[model samples]
Target: MKRFLSGTVPRFTLTFFCLWLASLKLIAQENARKVIRNIEIERHDVFTDLNRKPRFIYSWANQLHIVTRENVIRQELLFKSGDEYDAEILEESERKLRSLSYFGEVTVVVKTEGEAFVDVLVTTQDQWSTIVAYVFEGGGGRTTFGGGIEEFNFLGLGKRIFSEITHEVSEGTQIQLRYTDPQLFSSRWTARGNFITGPFLKDYSVRIIRPFYALDTKWAYGFTGFARDQTRRFFANSREFDRFREEKEEFQVFGARAFGSRFHKRRVQLGYRFSTKDITAVPDRMVVPLPDDEVSHALILTATFENLSFVEETQIDKFVRVEDLALGNITQVSLGRTGIPFPNGVKRFELRVIRSEAHQIFDRQYLFLTLGVQTLFEKNTIASFRLRYYNKFARRQTLGINIEFDYADSLEDSQLLLGGDSGLRGYPARAFTGDKRLLLNVEDRIFSSVNILTVQLGGVLFFDAGNVWSEETSINLNDLNYSAGFGLRLGYVKSPDSRVGRIDFGWALNGGGFGIVVGVDQIFSVN
Candidate 1:
């Protein structure tokens, strides 16, 4: 018995020792894997090289622009020294950098320093951040003119300050001021404030939020307050028939928690909101009955599902600029119930659903679809659907198609309209008003590989068809309005924002005459 026990004890000890050695080996292997040892930031000015045309202007622009601070760039990175190397995280970091309006380009690359160490290099090129410009838009014999000064990357700290003054034919003169800080106090919090005053309007809003900045973020919270007093006009056949005064105030606070893996995330949010809206008919103007006033103190619940994936593409929206296209699914459902009854002794229950899906159908073709529905239980409902498709059929050409449908049941003070100011582009603004609307647009886009003094050039030939149905009118397929036009696109490559200037001329097929439309950005956008 003593000999057997001695042999068993020795075998057990040997086995334990072997297992310990194996574990040590495994730990050593993990430690030997390549880790980020250093991070290098390379920042370029607005003009990296001044050898191109308009060198003098380019030099002056660069001199005027302040490059972003290194620490600011580092703060946006998802990784740092001593972290294990991950290509996906690096890609995400690049996307985050590019998302900033200050950067015209962003790239992240890793270099192996030794068997167990890596060096990460991050490169960014600044855009011309200070913009002093005039805004002009003329459509359907109506025009709006304005001028603004904006500092997108104020003091190179990634803050935005903007002030603008404008005059509109319908709204009189307006003055607007806005300030935004993406990283308030160098933390994850964001703050934004806007104030606008016009002869007919006074509006202001403030928001502070710590959003889900990353796919793996665990929690988020925010609060917002808004107040507006405005003159509302009701239009018929592009002419105002009635006017009213509206005053609204809103406040909301929310908190959210995220779950699931980085690739697919699910979030739930709880919130409370208080809002009041009042409308009164103008004394002298053609009087229309005021819409029902509303006051609500509500609790809100929301659930969202998102798939985190993106496709990096060029010339899709911005010419020659890198655009990260979200290519996946996102769905949200929200429910709200009011605890305090309205003055009419009625409680409110609301439901809202939104879904968007994007897919790459082919090597250079994509499709995007979105659906939204908002309903006040037993009172009213509004539903909207959109479809956008793009095909890069040639190396320098793309075909884009957009379709939109909006319908409402028991609409109150709002009206859906389609005309020159919308997408029709050939008739007077707000020529048609109704409870239901449908619009279709098709464009053949041609991109030029030409850069003239830093501006990129493109062109588009488009066709538009739309119709609206009032509640009293029956739907008719034969009543569709049609227009065809061509437009020029000027991409301000050096500008902080990626909006293109457009000028289009459209001829109405129904003998509504010709119109000219001038605006910024594409006429139809997926977002």
Candidate 2:
């Protein structure tokens, strides 16, 4: 009996549970449709459908098979029974459902129930989100491969469990594991933990966050504990590679208060952090001496404003797929101070800010801008801007133009660089370095309906130009490196908004070179 309970009983129990759910959905949908049809109601313009010959629409729902608890969906809904019908809210709820990545498609319908009331029905198609993905990339003077398995909605609770192993032929092998609970204990508190191990690197971190989404959740708080040990390679004075090793350990705690509703909230936060770093530098390829081992304890204060909106669909643009289009701006400002003692002794202060904005330019065109700035009170400052314009004309035809620029008064061993996998598609790995960098990219993405197995194929035509220069050097038009390429893309769209497996192949123009890469969305472009 014990053996049977352990084996056959569990399977039978799951089967029975699924059957029970299907039956419930069937009964509920039938009854709801009857209620909607029998209610005496005046005609509503919103509920009328001109596309259909009858003009009157009847609403129903189709529920897909899944283990997800119905309460999960109920909690995410922005409107409820007895509430006035709003098409915008219904569409917004559908977008949110799709964005969860658990559903392939979400459909919401509205029908008149009474003079001032409407009945709403939501239908969802579940996606196979338990992913076991493999990655293989090569050809750009480098080779890398890895695999990962993840469950984004573990136990139908919107939790995530992920594990991966990656190997770079020239570098080494790395293994990582991460777990996240967007909401714990059915509360707004979020928690995440991650660990990584490798021959030359190790990392571990645990964090908890209380977001300011609910009206009563004004006092948001977060805490994190982390440690890292890693070996890194860097170029000195625009020279060849040099090895550097670092060990970092830190802990932080923060709290915030929100001022408004979830849709339009501003926050003020304060935090304290303590950290220590140990460094080992190679003396041979040194352009400058490295900073000595040090410990830092600092207080940080920040203010952030958010006003973002989303649209379900747009007219004349067919490229609207699983995700909603974002429109609005988000900005944050932060100040930090590190000193011997809070009362008296002082060392240094830092300030940083960032902003991102998106807006519709024309019928099908959109513009996006992101800007960031960082400064150490007096010593140095760094600023960067990214501007993009794109048009989603159709499923197979899309155009985009992007400009990225960065400027820094100083250089650090572990700072941004211009070449390699990041831009400059045809440049060699880490081939350029300086205090200022600029890059421009233009691409025409063309997609195809060819699906081999679960993989969808696409292609792109691209052009890239970029340069990096130091304070002693001036920007020159002739100094810009040029590359043009054609690319192949492979995508596995098992989930609506989740990017499971993506690979890209790029070939440069003028016989410059060619490379292939794999990333979360498209390839990393490592030529």
- Residues 1-527, model 1: lDDT tens digits: 87986797889998999999999988987777788999999999999889987789989888888899998999899899999888888999999999998898899998556667889999999998988989788887678899999999999999999999988876688899999999899988999999999988899999999999887689999999999998887778888888888999999999999999988999999998888899887888755567778777888999999995788877777787788889999999999888742233237788999999999999989999999999996757889999999888988788999999998887666678888989998888898888889999999887788878877899999999998998888778788999998999998888886668889989898876899999988898656
lDDT of 2 by residue, 461-523 (tens): 788888788778888867887777776655554443434343445555534666665555533
Model 2: which ten-residue window has the lowest total lDDT?
Answer: 38-47
- Estimate the Cα RMSD of every predicted model relative to the unseen true structure: 5.6, 17.1
- TM-scores vs. true structure, each candidate: 0.92, 0.78
Could you tell me which 10 consecutive residues in candidate 1 have the lowest summed lDDT?
A: 339-348
Candidate 2: which stretches are off by over 4 Å?
1-66, 78-92, 108-120, 214-219, 236-240, 260-264, 282-287, 313-320, 340-346, 378-380, 496-511, 523-527
Candidate 1 lDDT for residue 185: 92
